[model samples]
Target: MAKRDYYEVLGLGKDASADDIKKSYRKLARQYHPDVNKEADAESKFKEVKEAYDVLSDDGKRSTYDRFGHVDPNQGMGGGGGAQDFGGFGDIFDMFFGGGGGRRDPNAPQRGNDLQYTMTVEFKEAVFGKETEITIPRTETCDTCHGNGAKPGTKPESCSVCKGSGQQEVVQNTPFGRMVNRRACTNCSGTGRVIKEKCGTCHGAGKVKRQRKINIRIPAGVDDGAQIRMSGEGEGGLRGGPAGDLYIVIRVKSHEFFEREGDDIYCEVPLTFVQATLGDEIEIPTLTEKVKLKVPAGTQTGTYFRLKGKGVPKLRGYGQGDQHVKVTIVTPTNLTDEQKELLRQFGGLSSDTSNEQEHHESIFERMKKAFRGE
Candidate 1:
């Protein structure tokens, strides 16, 4: 079968940018990789995508392909070339597997892996901030050999098989074409050095695991999912490289009454029905202290009041956020007989005075009118 246009195969147009071509190839490669996608034709589709990317990603190859539109590489398109001139598949594999495409010195410094610790803090503590210490187990450079993996008095020798390059090239003639790839040397296990006398403390690994104590100061107003980075606090590096960083991920526990959004705080306050009808001053709890809040006369349930500077401190800026207080009226229950009679009289008086107080509408009267459809 005639192969589809390279652009069409990757679901891209002819005018697609180099970045667009790479992104599309990566997406399709993951989608059709034989190990990941078990469909019958996935392998073929993956090869097709790979071929398109190999041609389009290189400027010289792309220009020739654009001009000639698929000339036999063996016939030499105005130049002596064949499948041997195609881009190396090692680069494609490296995109996913993190293998080095070119030669590299094994003794080069390599940074250590970063570490993350999830810290659960109390809600108030997150708002107020705290300083504490923690213990973590991590790898550190061996003190005896000083990261050389050899005894104090001895040193390592270069690998004879790979000649200290740490990698070996392999040429394979497959159905697709001739391909050259690099793999770790078997003699020295890619370290490029052989240790005759290993370090007693680290056992030739050049690193040892140990429990480390670290001090951490969590800033005020840190919310859930916030991360604090501590430099040079991660696992020890390899070959005298700098250590990686440590990240503390914060998780804030929910407060019993208060809730936070951004830097602002929200809470519900309960008010008696009588207090809602007749205004009263009540103490409300804040992050710092209790403050007096005046409930206006004839206040309704679910009414919100703002208390300035009573919420969490701004994490990045100077000022604090306001706290929103929502009042909910609570009804009285299990009244005494005398109190019940007084309530009944009060309802009657309210109905009688409805005309005098034009704004006041008795609950019973409203219900009666609703039932009568008046």
Candidate 2:
């Protein structure tokens, strides 16, 4: 069957952004996955969406697609390039899913896989910065073989199948004409060389699994889910390639008294009914110390007070963020008879209608303006 336009397959416009293409592909992949959908054509549809995403997600390929509606210009003709000619889909799957086949380098040493370790920190530790030590299990170079797959006395030999070309070509007949397709040499797995005598320690793989302890310092004001990348701390490189990176994902534990907003801290302060009505000075807890905040007379519930420079220090700035304290008036649930008598007398003297009138006027005026489209 003929192929459909990539944009149409992805349900996207011609000018869809890169992020849009990725989002669309993720949605489609999830919906059409064989594990998720047991329909007959789910696998084929999944492959189509993956193919479309493979082209549209790339800037260079998307430009080519935009200029020439389809990537296969010579479709149905023998001269058209096949799926193997396009960029390798395995690499795309590796980038997104991080698995399938192991990526190996022929010239350089093979590097180890990157590692991720989640570290939970107290709110203060996240705000003030702290150094932490963690141990991670990773692959390292074999000590006995020294990263070479050949035995100590014997060395690797050139692959006889492809004669060190690292590739093999196969000729096939197409509609246009006979064409030759090149693929990685199976004999040497595209490495151009083969190990005659395998190493005992690494079993000819040139790597060993080991545990490594690393120290990582987290900066101040790092929010939850912040990643700290440590270069060359991951798995050992194969052959002699550079080591991969280790990412420390930060997770901040929720504080008992405070919540974070960007760099600032927020907390709710409970105020007694008498304090909210008569006004008073109260001591509030901050990250460092307690500070006194003045409560205005007739302070209502949900009133906010700002404590300057009492929040978390900015990670990349000089000044610290302010702490916002929301005042919540706590009414007495159980009152003594004498207290109830005093409250009743106070309520009788209060001008509740005056307060209601002001509130009603403000709300009605806004509603009238909104209704009139003003």
Candidate 3:
């Protein structure tokens, strides 16, 4: 009989990946399997599915089929047949029967988890490196069972259902041929063993939770959202696997007087109208300390002065940034009688006129004048 295309039999496209092919085949196998289904022609559909999976699952067979659509019986394994020439489709069989199907072992040891710690630092501390300690809840392997998940006195036993094979097999008859399918043992959960008695401490988890102390050293010039990684400092790994990593995220506190942008510092210094009109040498606050700043003559409001090497330190390279000082002129108010007279005399000397206050006399003022007959 003419054979159908493997991808068509599995209800898959030619672009299907290995995983996609296996998933479709498993679902169809369970549905049409003669052992599982009692419908008529169930055996034939099951056989066809197995045969298609056999060709598509095996790498060499799939390659031959892709090029020639079929493997020649004469050129097959031992020059006899294709099935004999190639190995069993362990991928699906192991998945169904709970055996070694691929390159990875699900129960094998894996690297520990990676943890993140957000560490807040002062503005100065971020500019200059600091060392500090922190306490966190972490997971560690249990000392009682040594990560075996078994009690100290008793131990785990081989699964009786699978007889230490970790899988179960079923023989089914199909139109294409007779085949065998394997699946994981339901009793042992595919581990080939059962924990008759679990550890009292971890309760079969093989791990413990405890508070841990970690000391971290922050580098200089770290900006907000900067990240630092410490190796082998994460959660405990299973089966003695390597530890994971710990990441420290730096959060910098904002300064009251100074505002930072990249490596530069910004500040606004208030100056009186007299100081702005007549320039003088004044002291201004910087990131480090107060420094003498010369106010140029005729300095206007919103004028900016740059102080070199007075800002923040560079994160990676050498040298510092400049500090920008913005000057704002403050106008005087509440003039006394003597001050007002002097100001009026000064205004007369100048050509500019003083602002006149608007008079919005109400009806009551007119009534008072009329009652006095004025």
Candidate 4:
């Protein structure tokens, strides 16, 4: 494929200044950097941006390119200034910020990877809290080698290729000029150490996979999707680094009778027609125990009543939330002939123009409008 014009790649005209080229390159590099952009083509676009910047950032290369226009690599264009090839994203950052982009020491402490465990809790257990134990598989530093990845009484040797720096430098004479690049050493795989004798237990990996039993406490009133973090309880760190955290993600099992919304508990209580019309004291089940709830006379269906301090405990505060009970009047079924006749007689006692009938009709109309969001 033909190479794109350097000015076009940087989204600039031929008359663009050096400062404009640098600003456009920085913006494009940051936009297409693989670390920041996860698009599949971002890496290739980043390389294109870097290549464009490499030619335009220097005056000699820009002048040569302007004269030759994508000079063939086989017949190099003469240049007075050189450009350094960046190794990775770190190099770009080091160029923007003042740093040398030196190689890191592989023996330095690196924090362990964090682990997550999803736990399903019963509705009551989540509302009232409970302590439980779970077994999870994770990586732990080797006991025999003490996280060094070497056999007992033995040690790792410094990588001869990188001389313990974990990186190797390469110099190349490009069409532009001399270019230097730093890359991880292949001999030691960037670890800066070679293990002559591997540990038999962990197989020179410095860590072992094991099933560990962890005791966890689910706090009271923790709703579904709540997370409990346990510090230093994740996979063991490398080179004596501090362990990562263990996140316990709570998934609350649904209750058969109750539903929770934030700190409040909601439940639907069925009421017989007689009990709704003529008040009665009923036993209502709560998180702790059964409590007496009085149904007022002439209570309408879908009526909501609040039971103070009968809901789930507050996860962050002192008092508990109130439980909201919605009363639903259940029409009696399979009525005997005499019972049906009694209901008919009861209905006939209330005249069409009676004030009590009009009041009930008005209440039902208001409820209908409320349900319709009027």
Best by TM-score: 4
The lDDT per prediction is: 0.82, 0.77, 0.76, 0.82
* Count of clashing pairs, candidate 2: 10
Clashing pairs in 3: 77-85, 96-182, 96-183, 96-184, 97-182, 97-183, 97-184, 98-184
2 against 4, candidate with superior TM-score: 4
lDDT per residue (tens digit) for residues 280-370 in model 2: 9999999999889999988866667999999888987798999999987675778899998997776566636567665345423643554
After aligning candidate 4 to the native by TM-score, how far in Å is the CA of 67 from where it should be? 26
The 10-residue segment with the lowest total lDDT in model 4: 73-82
- lDDT tens digits by residue: candidate 4, 1-374: 99898899999999999999999999999999765675889989999999999878876567657866875533322343544445564443333344443435688997889899999989999999999999999999999998989999999999999898887777766665555556788999999999999999999999999999999988898889877888999999998988888988899999999989988889988888899889899988887888989999988778889989998899988889989998877778999999999987776664465577563654347456545656
TM-score of each: 0.70, 0.67, 0.61, 0.72
Off by over 4 Å in 2: 1-105, 108-113, 171-179, 352-374
Collision count for each candidate, in order: 0, 10, 8, 0
- Please state the error at residue 158 of candidate 3 in Å: 5.4
Q: Model 3 over residues 1-374: C-alpha lDDT tens digits? A: 88788899999988889999899999999999754575889989999999999878877557656866854443322332333321234433333345452433535776889888999999989987899999978888888997768999887777888876676666655443555556677888777768889999999777899899999998877789877888898988876777788888899999887888988989888877668767989999877688999998878666789999987788779988889998776656897999879866755654343433213333235335544556
After TM-score superposition, the amount by which residue 3's alpha carbon in candidate 3 deviates from its true location, in angstroms, is 33
| Per-residue lDDT of model 1, residues 16-129, tens digit only | 999999999999999998646758899899999999999899766676568657654334112433423323444333433565534357989988888989999999999999
Better of 2 and 3 by TM-score: 2
In model 1, the runs with Cα more than 4 Å from the true position are 1-88, 91-101, 169-181, 352-374
